[model samples]
Target: GAGVSQSPRYKVAKRGQDVALRCDPISGHVSLFWYQQALGQGPEFLTYFQNEAQLDKSGLPSDRFFAERPEGSVSTLKIQRTQQEDSAVYLCASSTDRGSVADTQYFGPGTRLTVL
Candidate 1:
Protein backbone atom coordinates (compact mmCIF):
# COMPACT_ATOMS: atom_id res chain seq x y z
CA GLY A 1 0.00 0.00 0.00
CA ALA A 2 2.57 2.52 -1.03
CA GLY A 3 1.25 6.04 -1.33
CA VAL A 4 2.50 9.49 -2.23
CA SER A 5 2.53 12.25 0.35
CA GLN A 6 3.29 15.94 0.32
CA SER A 7 4.30 18.30 3.08
CA PRO A 8 2.96 21.58 4.42
CA ARG A 9 -0.53 20.75 3.09
CA TYR A 10 -0.99 24.51 2.93
CA LYS A 11 1.38 27.42 2.49
CA VAL A 12 1.24 31.18 2.38
CA ALA A 13 3.95 33.17 0.66
CA LYS A 14 4.64 36.79 -0.08
CA ARG A 15 4.60 38.02 -3.66
CA GLY A 16 8.36 37.88 -4.04
CA GLN A 17 9.13 35.10 -1.65
CA ASP A 18 10.71 31.78 -2.41
CA VAL A 19 9.09 28.52 -1.39
CA ALA A 20 10.03 24.86 -1.44
CA LEU A 21 7.52 22.01 -1.47
CA ARG A 22 8.37 18.44 -0.70
CA CYS A 23 6.96 15.20 -2.05
CA ASP A 24 7.58 11.67 -0.86
CA PRO A 25 6.51 9.11 -3.40
CA ILE A 26 5.68 5.42 -3.15
CA SER A 27 8.72 3.36 -2.40
CA GLY A 28 10.43 1.88 -5.50
CA HIS A 29 8.36 3.86 -7.96
CA VAL A 30 10.61 4.89 -10.81
CA SER A 31 8.49 7.51 -12.47
CA LEU A 32 7.47 10.76 -10.76
CA PHE A 33 5.58 13.82 -11.84
CA TRP A 34 4.84 17.29 -10.51
CA TYR A 35 1.57 18.94 -11.34
CA GLN A 36 -0.02 22.33 -10.73
CA GLN A 37 -3.72 22.90 -10.36
CA ALA A 38 -5.25 26.35 -10.45
CA LEU A 39 -8.56 27.43 -9.01
CA GLY A 40 -10.82 25.88 -11.60
CA GLN A 41 -8.56 24.13 -14.03
CA GLY A 42 -7.53 20.50 -13.93
CA PRO A 43 -4.06 19.55 -12.84
CA GLU A 44 -1.40 20.56 -15.35
CA PHE A 45 1.80 18.67 -15.65
CA LEU A 46 4.82 20.58 -14.44
CA THR A 47 7.66 18.11 -14.65
CA TYR A 48 8.58 14.44 -14.87
CA PHE A 49 11.43 12.39 -13.56
CA GLN A 50 12.55 8.83 -14.14
CA ASN A 51 14.58 7.52 -11.29
CA GLU A 52 17.00 10.42 -10.61
CA ALA A 53 16.99 11.78 -14.13
CA GLN A 54 14.71 14.58 -15.26
CA LEU A 55 13.32 13.29 -18.57
CA ASP A 56 10.92 16.10 -19.36
CA LYS A 57 10.42 19.52 -17.87
CA SER A 58 8.80 21.35 -20.77
CA GLY A 59 5.58 21.77 -18.80
CA LEU A 60 7.10 24.02 -16.19
CA PRO A 61 5.64 27.51 -16.38
CA SER A 62 8.80 29.54 -15.98
CA ASP A 63 12.42 29.53 -15.05
CA ARG A 64 11.34 30.29 -11.52
CA PHE A 65 9.94 26.83 -11.13
CA PHE A 66 12.21 23.87 -10.46
CA ALA A 67 11.77 20.24 -9.43
CA GLU A 68 14.24 17.57 -8.48
CA ARG A 69 14.50 13.97 -7.35
CA PRO A 70 18.03 13.67 -6.05
CA GLU A 71 17.98 10.12 -4.76
CA GLY A 72 15.01 8.96 -6.84
CA SER A 73 12.62 8.63 -3.89
CA VAL A 74 11.92 12.06 -2.46
CA SER A 75 11.30 14.98 -4.77
CA THR A 76 11.22 18.71 -4.14
CA LEU A 77 9.65 21.54 -6.05
CA LYS A 78 11.12 24.98 -5.55
CA ILE A 79 9.55 28.22 -6.63
CA GLN A 80 11.58 31.40 -6.56
CA ARG A 81 10.22 34.94 -6.69
CA THR A 82 6.74 33.61 -6.30
CA GLN A 83 3.93 35.59 -7.90
CA GLN A 84 0.19 35.65 -7.30
CA GLU A 85 -0.31 33.51 -10.35
CA ASP A 86 1.91 30.93 -8.76
CA SER A 87 -0.70 30.19 -6.19
CA ALA A 88 -2.04 26.70 -6.80
CA VAL A 89 -2.18 23.15 -5.59
CA TYR A 90 1.05 21.29 -6.23
CA LEU A 91 0.52 17.59 -6.75
CA CYS A 92 2.95 14.70 -6.82
CA ALA A 93 2.29 11.44 -8.59
CA SER A 94 4.38 8.33 -8.97
CA SER A 95 4.20 5.10 -10.90
CA THR A 96 6.20 1.96 -11.18
CA ASP A 97 8.17 1.12 -14.33
CA ARG A 98 8.45 -2.61 -14.46
CA GLY A 99 8.41 -3.29 -18.18
CA SER A 100 4.75 -2.46 -18.28
CA VAL A 101 3.06 -0.67 -21.14
CA ALA A 102 1.05 1.51 -18.84
CA ASP A 103 1.63 2.22 -15.19
CA THR A 104 -1.00 3.63 -12.90
CA GLN A 105 0.06 6.79 -11.12
CA TYR A 106 -0.66 7.29 -7.45
CA PHE A 107 -1.18 10.91 -6.55
CA GLY A 108 -0.60 12.74 -3.32
CA PRO A 109 -3.06 15.03 -1.55
CA GLY A 110 -1.14 18.06 -2.85
CA THR A 111 0.28 21.17 -1.24
CA ARG A 112 -1.73 24.31 -1.70
CA LEU A 113 0.41 27.42 -2.13
CA THR A 114 -0.94 30.94 -1.85
CA VAL A 115 1.11 33.88 -2.95
CA LEU A 116 -0.31 37.10 -1.64
Candidate 2:
Protein backbone atom coordinates (compact mmCIF):
# COMPACT_ATOMS: atom_id res chain seq x y z
CA GLY A 1 0.00 0.00 0.00
CA ALA A 2 1.13 3.53 -0.66
CA GLY A 3 1.98 5.77 2.26
CA VAL A 4 2.95 9.32 2.99
CA SER A 5 6.54 10.39 2.39
CA GLN A 6 8.66 13.48 2.90
CA SER A 7 11.65 14.93 1.11
CA PRO A 8 15.11 16.05 2.16
CA ARG A 9 14.74 13.92 5.29
CA TYR A 10 17.39 16.16 6.81
CA LYS A 11 18.19 19.82 6.57
CA VAL A 12 20.71 22.29 7.91
CA ALA A 13 20.27 26.01 7.89
CA LYS A 14 21.78 29.08 9.41
CA ARG A 15 19.72 31.34 11.59
CA GLY A 16 17.44 33.59 9.55
CA GLN A 17 17.47 31.19 6.65
CA ASP A 18 14.30 30.12 4.89
CA VAL A 19 13.38 26.54 4.15
CA ALA A 20 10.68 24.49 2.50
CA LEU A 21 9.59 20.98 3.47
CA ARG A 22 7.52 18.78 1.23
CA CYS A 23 4.96 16.04 1.94
CA ASP A 24 3.37 13.65 -0.51
CA PRO A 25 0.33 11.92 0.88
CA ILE A 26 -1.36 8.72 -0.19
CA SER A 27 -3.48 9.25 -3.24
CA GLY A 28 -7.17 10.02 -2.69
CA HIS A 29 -6.82 10.75 0.98
CA VAL A 30 -9.27 13.47 1.85
CA SER A 31 -7.86 14.91 5.04
CA LEU A 32 -4.33 16.08 5.68
CA PHE A 33 -2.56 17.32 8.77
CA TRP A 34 0.78 18.80 9.71
CA TYR A 35 2.52 18.54 13.03
CA GLN A 36 5.78 19.70 14.56
CA GLN A 37 7.82 17.68 17.02
CA ALA A 38 10.60 19.30 18.96
CA LEU A 39 13.41 17.35 20.50
CA GLY A 40 12.10 15.22 23.36
CA GLN A 41 8.61 16.59 22.95
CA GLY A 42 5.39 15.19 21.58
CA PRO A 43 4.18 16.28 18.17
CA GLU A 44 2.10 19.42 18.13
CA PHE A 45 -0.56 20.00 15.56
CA LEU A 46 0.26 22.70 13.05
CA THR A 47 -2.55 22.70 10.53
CA TYR A 48 -5.31 20.73 8.85
CA PHE A 49 -6.60 20.62 5.30
CA GLN A 50 -9.66 18.92 3.88
CA ASN A 51 -9.25 18.39 0.21
CA GLU A 52 -7.72 21.62 -1.13
CA ALA A 53 -9.26 23.88 1.48
CA GLN A 54 -7.41 24.80 4.65
CA LEU A 55 -9.86 23.94 7.41
CA ASP A 56 -7.70 24.88 10.35
CA LYS A 57 -4.35 26.56 10.94
CA SER A 58 -4.54 27.80 14.50
CA GLY A 59 -1.44 25.90 15.49
CA LEU A 60 1.05 27.65 13.28
CA PRO A 61 3.61 29.16 15.64
CA SER A 62 4.10 32.40 13.77
CA ASP A 63 3.32 34.29 10.64
CA ARG A 64 6.73 33.34 9.34
CA PHE A 65 5.55 29.73 8.91
CA PHE A 66 3.19 28.87 6.10
CA ALA A 67 1.70 25.78 4.45
CA GLU A 68 -0.21 25.03 1.29
CA ARG A 69 -2.06 22.24 -0.51
CA PRO A 70 -2.57 23.50 -4.04
CA GLU A 71 -3.45 20.11 -5.49
CA GLY A 72 -4.99 18.23 -2.55
CA SER A 73 -2.34 15.49 -2.69
CA VAL A 74 0.97 17.21 -2.16
CA SER A 75 1.66 19.84 0.48
CA THR A 76 4.52 22.07 1.43
CA LEU A 77 5.48 23.78 4.63
CA LYS A 78 7.64 26.85 4.47
CA ILE A 79 9.49 28.47 7.31
CA GLN A 80 11.11 31.87 6.90
CA ARG A 81 13.63 33.70 9.05
CA THR A 82 14.29 30.52 10.86
CA GLN A 83 15.71 30.52 14.37
CA GLN A 84 17.51 27.76 16.21
CA GLU A 85 14.40 27.17 18.28
CA ASP A 86 12.56 26.36 15.08
CA SER A 87 14.48 23.13 14.66
CA ALA A 88 12.17 20.16 14.75
CA VAL A 89 10.65 17.25 12.85
CA TYR A 90 7.89 18.20 10.51
CA LEU A 91 5.31 15.44 10.09
CA CYS A 92 2.50 15.01 7.62
CA ALA A 93 -0.43 12.66 8.16
CA SER A 94 -3.39 11.83 5.99
CA SER A 95 -6.67 9.97 6.37
CA THR A 96 -9.52 9.10 4.13
CA ASP A 97 -13.05 10.45 4.38
CA ARG A 98 -14.83 7.42 3.07
CA GLY A 99 -17.31 5.42 5.07
CA SER A 100 -16.01 2.35 6.93
CA VAL A 101 -12.53 3.82 6.86
CA ALA A 102 -11.35 4.14 10.39
CA ASP A 103 -10.42 7.68 11.25
CA THR A 104 -6.82 6.63 11.40
CA GLN A 105 -4.08 8.80 10.06
CA TYR A 106 -1.06 7.48 8.21
CA PHE A 107 1.96 9.58 9.05
CA GLY A 108 4.88 10.29 6.82
CA PRO A 109 8.49 9.98 7.74
CA GLY A 110 9.23 13.45 8.99
CA THR A 111 11.51 16.07 7.55
CA ARG A 112 14.14 17.11 10.05
CA LEU A 113 15.14 20.75 10.07
CA THR A 114 18.00 22.23 12.03
CA VAL A 115 18.76 25.91 12.27
CA LEU A 116 22.31 26.79 13.20
Candidate 3:
Protein backbone atom coordinates (compact mmCIF):
# COMPACT_ATOMS: atom_id res chain seq x y z
CA GLY A 1 0.00 0.00 0.00
CA ALA A 2 1.10 3.58 -0.54
CA GLY A 3 0.02 4.55 2.94
CA VAL A 4 -1.40 3.00 6.10
CA SER A 5 -4.89 1.69 5.55
CA GLN A 6 -7.49 0.49 8.06
CA SER A 7 -10.79 -1.23 7.52
CA PRO A 8 -14.30 -0.62 8.83
CA ARG A 9 -13.66 3.00 9.61
CA TYR A 10 -16.57 2.77 12.03
CA LYS A 11 -17.74 -0.19 14.09
CA VAL A 12 -20.59 -0.67 16.54
CA ALA A 13 -20.43 -3.66 18.83
CA LYS A 14 -22.53 -4.99 21.67
CA ARG A 15 -21.02 -4.88 25.12
CA GLY A 16 -19.98 -8.50 25.09
CA GLN A 17 -19.24 -8.95 21.44
CA ASP A 18 -15.85 -9.31 19.87
CA VAL A 19 -14.49 -7.30 16.97
CA ALA A 20 -11.50 -7.37 14.68
CA LEU A 21 -9.87 -4.38 13.08
CA ARG A 22 -7.42 -4.62 10.22
CA CYS A 23 -4.48 -2.54 9.04
CA ASP A 24 -2.35 -2.50 5.90
CA PRO A 25 0.84 -0.53 6.24
CA ILE A 26 2.98 1.09 3.62
CA SER A 27 5.18 -1.10 1.51
CA GLY A 28 8.56 -2.04 2.99
CA HIS A 29 7.87 -0.56 6.38
CA VAL A 30 9.93 -2.29 9.01
CA SER A 31 7.96 -1.27 12.05
CA LEU A 32 4.24 -1.51 12.69
CA PHE A 33 2.35 -0.20 15.70
CA TRP A 34 -1.15 -0.26 17.09
CA TYR A 35 -2.57 2.49 19.23
CA GLN A 36 -5.78 3.29 21.05
CA GLN A 37 -7.13 6.80 21.16
CA ALA A 38 -9.95 7.64 23.48
CA LEU A 39 -12.10 10.60 22.64
CA GLY A 40 -10.45 13.92 23.39
CA GLN A 41 -7.15 12.19 24.19
CA GLY A 42 -3.88 11.53 22.42
CA PRO A 43 -3.19 8.14 20.97
CA GLU A 44 -1.69 5.60 23.37
CA PHE A 45 0.61 2.91 22.08
CA LEU A 46 -0.89 -0.55 22.42
CA THR A 47 1.65 -2.75 20.75
CA TYR A 48 4.62 -2.72 18.37
CA PHE A 49 6.00 -5.19 15.90
CA GLN A 50 9.36 -5.28 14.20
CA ASN A 51 8.87 -7.33 11.06
CA GLU A 52 7.13 -10.52 12.26
CA ALA A 53 8.30 -10.17 15.84
CA GLN A 54 6.02 -8.67 18.43
CA LEU A 55 8.61 -6.64 20.31
CA ASP A 56 6.26 -4.87 22.72
CA LYS A 57 2.75 -5.15 24.06
CA SER A 58 3.02 -3.37 27.37
CA GLY A 59 0.25 -0.89 26.68
CA LEU A 60 -2.57 -3.31 25.98
CA PRO A 61 -5.24 -2.69 28.59
CA SER A 62 -5.99 -6.36 29.28
CA ASP A 63 -5.63 -9.90 28.03
CA ARG A 64 -8.78 -9.45 26.02
CA PHE A 65 -6.81 -7.47 23.49
CA PHE A 66 -4.65 -9.28 20.97
CA ALA A 67 -2.68 -8.13 17.93
CA GLU A 68 -0.68 -9.87 15.27
CA ARG A 69 1.36 -9.04 12.20
CA PRO A 70 1.94 -12.38 10.61
CA GLU A 71 3.70 -11.29 7.40
CA GLY A 72 5.08 -8.04 8.75
CA SER A 73 2.90 -6.07 6.38
CA VAL A 74 -0.68 -6.39 7.47
CA SER A 75 -1.89 -6.53 11.08
CA THR A 76 -5.03 -7.22 13.02
CA LEU A 77 -6.26 -6.17 16.41
CA LYS A 78 -8.93 -8.30 18.02
CA ILE A 79 -10.85 -7.24 21.08
CA GLN A 80 -12.89 -9.82 22.92
CA ARG A 81 -15.92 -9.17 25.10
CA THR A 82 -15.93 -5.53 24.32
CA GLN A 83 -16.80 -3.15 27.12
CA GLN A 84 -18.01 0.43 27.09
CA GLU A 85 -14.62 1.43 28.34
CA ASP A 86 -13.07 -0.23 25.33
CA SER A 87 -14.76 2.09 22.87
CA ALA A 88 -12.16 4.22 21.17
CA VAL A 89 -10.43 4.92 17.89
CA TYR A 90 -7.92 2.24 17.04
CA LEU A 91 -5.03 3.52 14.97
CA CYS A 92 -2.33 1.71 13.03
CA ALA A 93 0.99 3.26 12.12
CA SER A 94 4.16 2.23 10.38
CA SER A 95 7.71 3.44 10.05
CA THR A 96 10.85 2.37 8.28
CA ASP A 97 12.82 2.47 11.52
CA ARG A 98 11.99 -0.06 14.19
CA GLY A 99 11.76 1.19 17.76
CA SER A 100 14.04 4.07 17.08
CA VAL A 101 13.36 7.31 18.92
CA ALA A 102 13.76 9.21 15.67
CA ASP A 103 11.28 7.11 13.74
CA THR A 104 8.46 9.09 12.21
CA GLN A 105 5.29 7.03 12.09
CA TYR A 106 2.64 7.35 9.41
CA PHE A 107 -0.80 6.74 10.88
CA GLY A 108 -3.97 5.37 9.39
CA PRO A 109 -7.28 7.14 9.63
CA GLY A 110 -8.31 4.59 12.27
CA THR A 111 -11.23 2.35 13.12
CA ARG A 112 -13.68 4.01 15.42
CA LEU A 113 -15.20 1.37 17.68
CA THR A 114 -18.30 2.10 19.69
CA VAL A 115 -19.34 -0.39 22.32
CA LEU A 116 -22.85 -0.19 23.64
Candidate 4:
Protein backbone atom coordinates (compact mmCIF):
# COMPACT_ATOMS: atom_id res chain seq x y z
CA GLY A 1 0.00 0.00 0.00
CA ALA A 2 1.17 3.50 -0.84
CA GLY A 3 0.38 4.89 2.54
CA VAL A 4 3.03 5.57 5.16
CA SER A 5 6.07 3.36 5.81
CA GLN A 6 8.76 3.39 8.50
CA SER A 7 12.13 1.67 8.66
CA PRO A 8 14.13 -0.01 11.41
CA ARG A 9 10.82 -1.32 12.66
CA TYR A 10 12.50 -2.26 15.92
CA LYS A 11 15.56 -0.93 17.68
CA VAL A 12 17.58 -1.72 20.77
CA ALA A 13 19.96 0.88 22.16
CA LYS A 14 22.05 1.19 25.26
CA ARG A 15 21.71 4.27 27.36
CA GLY A 16 23.45 7.29 25.85
CA GLN A 17 23.30 5.84 22.38
CA ASP A 18 21.77 7.56 19.35
CA VAL A 19 19.17 6.17 16.99
CA ALA A 20 17.55 7.27 13.77
CA LEU A 21 14.15 6.30 12.42
CA ARG A 22 12.86 6.81 8.90
CA CYS A 23 9.53 7.50 7.35
CA ASP A 24 8.25 7.48 3.77
CA PRO A 25 4.88 9.10 3.37
CA ILE A 26 2.44 8.67 0.55
CA SER A 27 3.35 10.55 -2.63
CA GLY A 28 1.86 14.04 -2.85
CA HIS A 29 0.96 14.16 0.80
CA VAL A 30 1.55 17.56 2.29
CA SER A 31 1.31 17.10 6.02
CA LEU A 32 3.76 14.99 8.04
CA PHE A 33 3.72 14.19 11.72
CA TRP A 34 5.79 12.35 14.32
CA TYR A 35 4.56 10.93 17.60
CA GLN A 36 5.87 8.99 20.58
CA GLN A 37 4.11 6.33 22.60
CA ALA A 38 5.17 4.90 25.91
CA LEU A 39 4.15 1.51 27.10
CA GLY A 40 0.37 1.24 27.68
CA GLN A 41 -0.04 4.84 26.65
CA GLY A 42 -1.55 6.61 23.72
CA PRO A 43 0.60 8.30 21.13
CA GLU A 44 1.58 11.87 21.79
CA PHE A 45 2.36 14.36 19.08
CA LEU A 46 6.04 15.18 18.71
CA THR A 47 6.24 17.47 15.72
CA TYR A 48 4.75 18.31 12.38
CA PHE A 49 5.80 19.59 8.98
CA GLN A 50 4.10 21.16 6.05
CA ASN A 51 6.08 20.24 2.99
CA GLU A 52 9.70 20.92 3.88
CA ALA A 53 9.01 23.43 6.60
CA GLN A 54 8.72 22.40 10.24
CA LEU A 55 5.61 24.05 11.60
CA ASP A 56 5.43 22.71 15.12
CA LYS A 57 7.79 20.99 17.52
CA SER A 58 6.14 21.77 20.83
CA GLY A 59 5.63 18.14 21.62
CA LEU A 60 9.22 17.01 21.46
CA PRO A 61 10.27 15.74 24.88
CA SER A 62 13.57 17.61 24.87
CA ASP A 63 16.27 19.17 22.76
CA ARG A 64 17.78 15.75 22.22
CA PHE A 65 14.92 14.75 19.96
CA PHE A 66 15.00 16.06 16.40
CA ALA A 67 13.11 15.51 13.19
CA GLU A 68 13.39 16.75 9.62
CA ARG A 69 11.70 16.39 6.28
CA PRO A 70 14.40 17.56 3.91
CA GLU A 71 12.51 17.01 0.64
CA GLY A 72 8.98 16.74 2.01
CA SER A 73 8.63 13.12 0.93
CA VAL A 74 10.89 11.24 3.31
CA SER A 75 11.49 12.24 6.90
CA THR A 76 13.73 11.14 9.75
CA LEU A 77 13.56 11.32 13.51
CA LYS A 78 16.65 11.19 15.65
CA ILE A 79 17.02 10.59 19.34
CA GLN A 80 20.34 11.37 20.99
CA ARG A 81 21.59 10.29 24.41
CA THR A 82 18.96 7.66 24.57
CA GLN A 83 17.44 7.07 27.98
CA GLN A 84 15.14 4.43 29.36
CA GLU A 85 12.42 7.04 29.47
CA ASP A 86 12.87 7.51 25.73
CA SER A 87 11.93 3.93 25.03
CA ALA A 88 8.73 3.98 23.02
CA VAL A 89 7.19 3.51 19.64
CA TYR A 90 7.80 6.27 17.14
CA LEU A 91 4.92 6.72 14.77
CA CYS A 92 4.85 8.70 11.55
CA ALA A 93 1.77 9.90 9.77
CA SER A 94 0.79 11.88 6.69
CA SER A 95 -2.32 13.59 5.55
CA THR A 96 -3.25 14.50 2.03
CA ASP A 97 -4.46 17.77 3.42
CA ARG A 98 -4.01 19.86 6.54
CA GLY A 99 -6.00 22.40 8.57
CA SER A 100 -9.33 20.79 7.94
CA VAL A 101 -11.13 19.33 10.92
CA ALA A 102 -12.13 16.42 8.76
CA ASP A 103 -8.76 15.66 7.28
CA THR A 104 -7.61 12.11 7.95
CA GLN A 105 -4.09 11.17 9.01
CA TYR A 106 -2.67 7.93 7.69
CA PHE A 107 -0.16 6.26 10.01
CA GLY A 108 2.84 4.04 9.48
CA PRO A 109 3.34 0.79 11.33
CA GLY A 110 5.79 2.50 13.66
CA THR A 111 9.32 1.91 14.94
CA ARG A 112 9.71 0.67 18.47
CA LEU A 113 12.79 1.75 20.37
CA THR A 114 13.98 0.07 23.51
CA VAL A 115 16.69 1.71 25.56
CA LEU A 116 18.55 -0.11 28.27
Per-residue lDDT of 103 in model 4? 75
Q: Pick the candidate with the highest TM-score.
A: 1
Candidate 4 lDDT for residue 102: 61
* lDDT at position 37, candidate 1: 96
Q: Which lDDT tens digits does candidate 1 get at residues 21-62?
A: 999999999999999999899999999999999999999999
Report model 2's TM-score to 2 decimal places: 0.94
**lDDT computed for candidate 4:** 0.94
> What residue pairs clash in candidate 1, if any at all?
none
Residues 1-116, model 4: lDDT tens digits: 57799999999999999999999998999999999988899999999999999999999999999999998889999999999999999999999875576678999999999999
- The candidate, 3 or 4, that scores higher on lDDT is 3
What overall lDDT goes with each candidate model? Answer: 0.95, 0.93, 0.95, 0.94
Q: Candidate 2, which segments miss by more than 4 Å at Cα?
A: 99-102
| Model 2, C-alpha of 66: deviation from truth (Å) | 0.4
In candidate 3 the C-alpha lDDT for residue 13 amounts to 99
Q: Residues 1-116, candidate 3: write the lDDT tens digits.
A: 37899998999999999999999999999999999999999999999999999999999999999999998889999999999999999999999986468899999999999999
What pairs collide in candidate 4? none
List RMSD in Å for every model shown: 0.9, 1.6, 1.4, 1.1
Q: What is the Å distance of residue 9 in model 4 from its true position?
A: 0.4
Query: For residues 57-100, what per-residue lDDT tens digits would candidate 2 score against the true structure?
Result: 99999999999999888999999999998999999999997756
